[model samples]
Target: MSATIHRIGGREPSLEPMLSLVAPDLNLVNAVILDRMNSDIPLIPELAGHLIAGGGKRMRPMLTLASARLLEYSGTRHHKLAAAVEFIHTATLLHDDVVDSSDLRRGRRTANIIWGNPASVLVGDFLFSRSFELMVEDGSLKVLKILSGASATIAEGEVNQLTAVRRIDLSEERYLDIIDAKTATLFAAACKIAAVVAERGEREESALDAYGRNLGIAFQLVDDAIDYISTAEAMGKDAGDDFREGKMTLPVILAYARGSEGDRAFWKEAVAGRRVADEDFAEAVRLVQASRAVEDTLARARHYGQRAIDALGGFAPGGAKDAMVEAVEFAVARAY
Candidate 1:
């Protein structure tokens, strides 16, 4: 399908439909989250809540809810599972902020910055434990296997990314692999578990997995592009953060390959942590734009977004399917 389909009638795609569809379930999920994050150690909930209550779309859990809705599921089993997914995601964010030494997230001080890295890491571990508890409570060995395996894969991906940091030679293929493990795995699991709860066959499970995995990839790609093109206010974090941190995201990868010799040299220096001034970031943006790196990065996102939409082809048409499709459109349209 054409990327232009996301922009039909010159209207912007919004998450409103999906959010509206899942709001009731999401409220229950939030209740589970609140009840689980509590501990006698006040610091546990305090730190966890800092990030959890902070601005976030709760996209992963909402996918689980929406996928259940698409399957016409009536039971409440997915509620705890959706909350589990959010806990896992939130745990990752806490750990990620510490790893990146990020001070700002969602336009506020990151957990690590406020409570320190040790506290943040420990609280992340606490949330992970809570997620596993929810999974075990649901009494599904299959669900346990999927979520636990995803947690391990996310750690592996983090290590891979850590090793690849500051290496301008990082291949596009390797980068995609890293993101698939780190970000897409959970998305796939979240959706796939909905099928499991609905007791659907393998074909339906695989389809939801494909839809979610592709959407996750598209979501991360848009985020990669936004780092260079958007403002801190707009992005909820400082723009050019990836450049300053020397993270080898897709835009930098493409720009370096397509840039002139001088441009490549500049990128090397920037990625090596020598050129981090605002002027250097401006030049990096110029190079990326000149080489159409950001543009093409967004194009790649649209490709995966289309794949996500196509994966839903077998599902019956309804508000659920339309919301899911528009969710993909919203994911790919953010960069525009």
Candidate 2:
């Protein structure tokens, strides 16, 4: 697809303030991250450092930390919980890169490409084990169960996507199911763990869980929408990755549904028949624009983002609450 990328067509909300609000707790989370990344085996830390040092926002752990403080949590257990959340996220990133056969992550060479898939997967396993260890040491049965269930769900989601390869007829319902498992489950867990540690009752825990889940859904929705609307520079990776991979993201699903009989055949050939040429991508841009697929995708993202914002209604107005709201706005508007 020899096309210029465009940015998301709306204003973006900065997450800087949110990060700043959680900065102190995040520092403690960072300490735990560095401490736990250590291994006497030597290569484990080296391989893991390559990805960790590449540096994305590390938002999952931050969510845990911020959620904890939002409830005025006094104990230090959230620090370990936050670290565990990060380990789980990092492990998933490692596994995702391997599954996608990706070479770059956060604009650096993926651990798999540099150290080989064997090392990447093993180190990912180590991180997952480390996360479980953190949860166990915290000795919260509720925390352990919630995080472990989320971990298992993440694995199941990956497997589901593996089975979805080349199946472009994937329905939006199923697609959401996959993302809820793979992405939102952890976000939900990250937020819910705060309530758990705070000893906040079920109402607050469920609300926080809903907030994270909806925020995560909005976040991934923007990413899917951006594949059609964003620039290569903005995306930090090539657009049309979903199409190239034959994955049925929202835009593709909508386009496929609304397209004509001939259009459907074209899509089937491009993906299911495994005969994609460059022009197919160019035509994809056309179909996506014609169908207003990107707009619809973002509308869905906004809907979920609004739901995420609404989830915080019970909480009083404060910096942490405000930051969480801004974080949801950021999720939906990130492509912008």
Candidate closest to the true structure, highest TM-score: 1
State how far residue 233 of model 1 sits from its true place (Å). Answer: 0.5
What's the TM-score of each model vs. the native? 0.98, 0.94
Clashing pairs in 1: none
lDDT of candidate 2 vs native? 0.86
lDDT tens digits, residue span 86-124, model 2 = 899999999998998886666677888888999999999
Candidate 1 — what's its lDDT? 0.94
Model 1: per-residue lDDT, tens digit, 1-336? 236445535678989999999999999999999999999999999999989999899999999999999999999999999999999999999999999999899999999988899999999999999999999999999989989999999999999999999999999999999999999999999999999999999999999999999999999999999998999999999888899999999999999999889999999999999999999999999999999999999988998999999999999999999999999999998887
What is the RMSD of candidate 2?
4.4
- Give the runs in model 2 whose Cα sits over 4 Å from its true position: 1-12
